[model samples]
Target chain A: MSYRIEELLITTLAPMLEGLEHVAVGAASPIPGAAALLARHRGGGRPRVSMLASRRHASFTDGARELFDCAAQGRIDAFFLGGGQIDGSANINLVGIDGYPASRVRFPGSFGSAFMYFVVPRVILFSLEHSRRVMVPRVDFVSAPGTSPSNVYRPGGPYALVTSRCVFRFDRDRGRFALASVHPGQTLEDIREQTGFDFDVPARIEQTPAPGAQDLVLIRGPVGKDISETYPDFARRVLELDAATA
Target chain B: MTNLETLVEAIHDGASVALAPDYSGCAMAAVRALVRRGARDLRLIAVPQAGFQADMLIGAGCVGSVEAAAITLGEYGFAPRFTDAVKNGRITLRDSTCPAIHAGLQAAEKGVPFMPLRGILGSDLLTHRDDWKVIENPFSPDDAIVALPAIRPDVALFHAASADRHGNVWIGVRRELMLMAHAAHRTLVTVETVVDDDLLADEARAAGTIPALYVSAIAEVREGAWPIGLAGRYPADAAHLAEYARLARTAAGFERYLDEHVRGRASAA
Candidate 1:
């Protein structure tokens, strides 16, 4: 009857990956990794998952350049990006906080996020923390802008933003997020209170679907084992796969 | 001469130096040696990104600027010194995306003034960079793209699993080192061992070899990438890195770490 937030997030994201040929998961993403694996399992391995950190998932032998090159050549269909701060416009900031150049707080500088965001067709933006501190009115810096100008030759942009509180599908033409559904335990008021940015709230919000028994079985068994090498701590802690397998 | 001192001496103050990405084949031995030698105010370039070497250099106040994609300790968590220095505005942070860094070096590798890159048009990374230009494709004329100037560092430094007497280094799958070597003005390498025979003579090993012509100097330093592993040669010293992460939280703690592990010791290993 009950499911973990990770499982819920995975299930929420799985549909976005419906017919994607190749999905690439970036650094520090255990949930997205699980979701990608789950999507693959559900698709009978249709959408190939390439995790930058995983030996099992990554097919590239050349190095980081190859990953970038692959994305450039339009090989990667879906990708995941996270940020220190993500805003209403779908702009994600992975750079430091407070200001430009000099900031009071600093995160690891933007890795391949900017380049990947522009190329990957289905860019699912997810952050585990959804407080106002994170979901600001505007990020101090934009590591990857959610949308691009019409003449910019852009092929990919933000599809949706999945947070701990709710799911907001990004309307590219409007350049704003529309609240689609709230997680089961969370309320619209909770999302409103926690989120710093403004969004278009639908007349009725749907409940984010909970993972079924079969989803949990796949998550706990094969998917958990697949991501273990890349995310040993996450697999052990979240899924409790270590004890289950042991 | 292919000695440790010579390799360190080649990297002068304010020199734009490029290094390989973390966990591949980090030249930790050279990094420690540079610290021990009091190399200062160097503009460090992490080819795509960096970790221990960049953090340690920043903590030592040896770095003047950092141009990279990201600088984190991966599974180990935040890179403290780099984070602290950036917050304090101690170092000039030229934040970049991963492919851009690679593309920039690639331009240098081809001896080009600049290279065209797809993506980054809408990203703030483009807005902040004066050096990066947005232009219509000359041939296509209809397509808009971003062009990055060449990032030709003054020196390229990395460690490898092995090198022969002839000075060819075997890097296997870590081709970024080769890119760094080709892009920079000079290449410095430290290897785990010096083989008796030439690496290029063996067809299998030769494909992975960066020829001696590209290598300015080579030093055989055992466990060169100590805290960071040398690919297949050894595993990372996790306890030592954990100790580093623990101690490098503050300036004083970092200095204490430097004294014990860096300056006080005869060598890092």
Candidate 2:
């Protein structure tokens, strides 16, 4: 079935959430929020999805700190983090380029990644802008490391990275990412050329599967409606659903 | 009841102020008043993250430093003035993570010297923050954890849905205000309306109410969180925020915004 890139991304991300107890999405993330909702919709509502800043969808009553507090207690099974720059080793920099205090370019400071990346068992690094600038050789600053030392009391680390171009599953043990699959119409060479960091590639590369009819129906209908409440512009532009009319 | 200006006057120059996040209760009216009064050298502490309030304060040159996990305008995009300030070295940016900020405030709330938190052992934030320390868990050998010094602000400022004659403020589910009030030496509040009925009279309302003992002052400013909105009370004025995000991209445009909206101008409502 022909699908928009957003639908393709939602489908790609949904499976990762299967069997997870609770998945939490942070502010300004629509795709992962939609995907988590899709996963919940498909899983007969097994995994609870918490989309921050949404009055209708949020499960937390204790306020903003509750999210980090819950994650610390191992209540949140998965989370999504984006960065201004991400490297192959899975070090994500949400701070800025150059050095600290005197950074030439400043992206938003690390919201919860420094803590969330270590506590949440599965941290999915998602950034739609897949290019050399965003996927850097080395992040200017390490907002959160992809892996911690063996002795560190860390139960969570980088799980996989989903970009517009392809999927890279992070091996925490090896401290490296291996190419999982390229999205439709993308090549291995395209990913290699665009990506600043190096990664492992499988002998038989696979094309990321498109959203099936059922997936599209869920994405276009209920999931779109649910996400629209929090991210109206994204839903209207990407999902093409006018929240008022829908 | 004290007027809005009086409440703003309580926040003197160079005061260390704590503010709630964009999604939580934001005292935007007080923020504008602070800009109008040209309050200087203020240290802003964002409880995890911030938005327009921080940007406007920085843009107006009222801020000396900012300690925040992140500062962004949410769907509206990056907080322009905050970005400008950090890039130009106009303000000291003390980068922090969400839980660490919360932990600091929690420590102050509990009258403790510091609180221990997991993670942040390897991140560069530890390098920048001289205040945070790492210590071995005395109970468990060789297990290290980060300890954050208590954050005690001079004032915790925010707007709430309503307040009673007794000065108790009702914030509904936005409980971070409680933490801010507990951690700060003083709390200044603006409310949508001062209800004649006691908010603490009802058990349900009292559960969500910040008692008058914690509140130092209160003012009734209708739609005090204009453009930012209060949870369950009103939706954010997205068009206004979008326009702000657009105009604040440049320094001159930001001044124009302040002149039109903040200085000597009537409330947007």
Candidate 3:
């Protein structure tokens, strides 16, 4: 049986968030938000989830100011980031493509990405589209760089890069990504052909784990309902929860 | 003095102006008025991030520089005008992160030279910024962090749910507006209503209010945060924003939009 790509993504990110105290999901992120809620549901709410746009999920009263302060104080453990383009070195470009001031393609300006990428210990780089255009040889501009010098006093960085096709673990020391697992429907060659950047491949690649039966039940049931409050369309489309039914 | 245009005239060309972020109380009425007044070359600072207000201003050619973490329309997608401007090298882009902006504004509020921030250790933002410095913490030489310069602005502008006759504005949990007001030389506000009742008499309400001393001008404009909406008062006009996104794709369409909505409406004002 084939599981949905979103299901696989949720399961993949859940483990990364294990034993974390808190995980924050920014606006416009549905998969990561669902995964954070799923992790909380599975772990008996061990890792508190903070959804930037959701009233129920957010605890702070001061909005982005509080969110920024919490990240600065090292209260948030995990965060999700996406870019217009991402490179082998884990550099992301949230700004436009081509150059700083001039570009052909433009994305939304960099929000709390650079700040959170530095402060959050386990920053997961995710993107739904894993094509060569997105996963680039080098990002046009670095919105938040993956690594810094040893003397930079950095405690946080890209822990892993998860895409629809595969999962790659970021090696800070080597400043390169290592192929971890190929998604169920994809082959290593498929990843290689689509990826713009080079990466290290192990002798044996594992299949990305699928969501368990029980996990699916939680995902389809209460978790689906919980996320609907924040991501209505995602819940309706991905989980097949209709407005009347949900 | 109570007129929107008169209030907008207080802000001059090439002035550094700070505005609240998307989720905060956005003064769309005042923003429209500013566009009408042909305010140009403003260094518009988003408390952290902004959406349509920034996009519309950028499109109207009323801004010279934008300093923010991001300019987006949230689920609706990239801010088209802002995107186009950045792509064409038309505006000064001060790419920043959330905490850096907040800390810089806070530094200005406290009359400090600079404020040390926790992160930016590995970010390209640090490398790009000339104003930011990385210093070994004298408290702990082992620890190094980024220090941001003060971001004192010429004016701070926003909309509020209500303001009292005394000019104290009730902002509730949107405390960043207070920081913006404190850090700027002049704070101009547009409120949904100006109540005669004194808000300071109630300690609970007073705690959330920006006292009149910091407020330079207050204009009573009903439904002030139109199209974007005021928190707890009204919701954003999603259909209108969607229409805006659709039409704002082309320069001609954007101009048409400006004429129909912004320029046209301002003429009526």
Task: Please state every model's RMSD to the true fold in angstroms.
Answer: 1.8, 1.2, 1.9
Instruction: Give every collision pair in model 1.
Output: none
Q: After superposition, how far is residue B240 of candidate 2 from its true place, in Å?
A: 1.5
Which sections of candidate 2 miss by over 4 Å?
A: B266-269
Off by more than 4 A, model 1? A243-246, B267-269
Winner of 1 and 3 under DockQ = 1
Give the candidate number with the greatest DockQ.
Answer: 2
Give one digit per residue, the lDDT tens place, for model 3 in B1-269.
27788888899999988988777888888888888788899899988888888998899899999999888888788888998898888998888888889999999999998999876666667777888998889987778878899999999999998999888999988888998999999999999888889989999999899999999999888888888877789988989989999888788999998888887897444
TM-score each candidate: 0.96, 0.98, 0.95
| The best candidate in terms of TM-score | 2
Error of 1 at A239 (Å): 1.5
Once model 3 is optimally superposed onto the true structure by TM-score, how far is the C-alpha of residue A88 displaced, in angstroms? Answer: 1.7
| lDDT values, one for every candidate | 0.87, 0.92, 0.87
Q: B116-158 in candidate 1: lDDT tens per residue?
A: 9998877778887889998899898679888999999999999
